[model samples]
Target chain A: MQFDVRLFALYRERAGASIVTIDLPEGASAGDLTAAVRADYPRLAPPEVRIVVAVNAEYADDDQLLQPGDEVCLIPPVSGGC
Target chain B: MIILTDEPLDPVAVTDSVRRDGNGAVVTFLGTTRDNFGGKEVTRLEYEAYDVMAIKKLQEVRDTLRADYGIEDIAIAHRTGRVDVGHISLVVAVASPHRVQAFEACHEAVNRIKTIVPIWKKEWFADGSRWVACEDHEFADEAEHAHAHAERHAVAAGD
Candidate 1:
């Protein structure tokens, strides 16, 4: 299955594109997608820094399953002033 | 109803939407564009959003607050496009039978909106413009990891 993943904020800048489509196995979890992302984008791999993910616009756990048409978004920490 | 508009936000209208006869306590919070952020002089602030997702997420926030606090009435409005300094950017109004619930719900609503909403804001400073929350990308990445893991296992099990 192929899923459209969105990158925002710093990730978007680093990725140089707002969205990317990646091919995954039929049943891929959010973690698998993260690994795939790290594999695809070495800049986003672990140990350097962590990135947050939102599946279908809501925060999803690493164990959460994704549907084909689900909107997967990568949100960086907000730097807004309170 | 959840509102996503380019027009300036109105706190009074948002407050009115949450006003209920049975609820004695109403708490309203308005988020505005400040003149400065982290020592930078902000000339203006620009907000952008995936409107469809933003509205859906806003509605989810409203529903969650209602369920968690038993708040019958709530309203959340966020502004898009350019907003001048001191202008309202977001408004959240929540009503409950008691003051505590109203206050708690209102705070949670705002916090969740900031954390989960798809809207993005760019602060145009005198020197440069920066996207808010550009550094923290771990939350969404983790979510994606979890979702992918779930899908993989499900496929293995043929479910």
Candidate 2:
């Protein structure tokens, strides 16, 4: 399966690209997407970091299943304020 | 009203929209860009938002506050792109039948927006710039991150 993930804030700055596409097995979970992103773009975060994931605008657990065309967003630690 | 705009925010318009009969008070919050941070001379600020998520979360906050505190009306407007010092970055307005719930609901609205909204603020210091609290509470350690995220969120909500 192919998944296109949206990036924001630090992840976009680090990755230097707003969207990343990852190829995975048919039954990939959010965790698998995280691992693949880490492997592909190490600069996005340190190896040990586990960034947040959002599926269709809602926070999704690491075990959440991925649909082929799901609108996934990679959320770094949010720092919203004045 | 819950909005994400790249244009300037008008607090008057936002607060006025929430005005209605039987509302005794309306509280509005304007989060402006400060001129300094930790002794650094700041020049301006840049804000970004996951528009879809941020707006959704803003609506969620309004709904939650209405149910939680029985507030009558609320409005939230956030700016995107670049914002200079002393300019408004956020506006949260709430109305209720009394003063207490108006203030309380507005307070909670601001708190919840920071904790959950996918908006980000980048501080532009004179010599350098940084994304405040971006990595300070995230991506450092695995075991303590859950706690740190919660604690940082508390700190954020408190502010």
List DockQ for all candidates.
Answer: 0.14, 0.48
What candidate 2 keeps of the native contacts, as a fraction, is 0.50
Fraction of true contacts kept, per model? 0.13, 0.50
RMSD of each: 7.5, 4.6
Superposition error at B69 for model 2 (Å): 0.5
lDDT per residue for candidate 1 within B59-82, as digits (tens), equals: 898998888987789999898888
* TM-score for the A chain of candidate 2: 0.93
Candidate 1 DockQ, CA atoms: 0.14
- Give the Cα error of residue B94 in candidate 2, in Å: 0.6
Worst 10 residues of 2 chain B by lDDT: B134-143
Q: In model 1, state the lDDT of residue A47.
A: 36
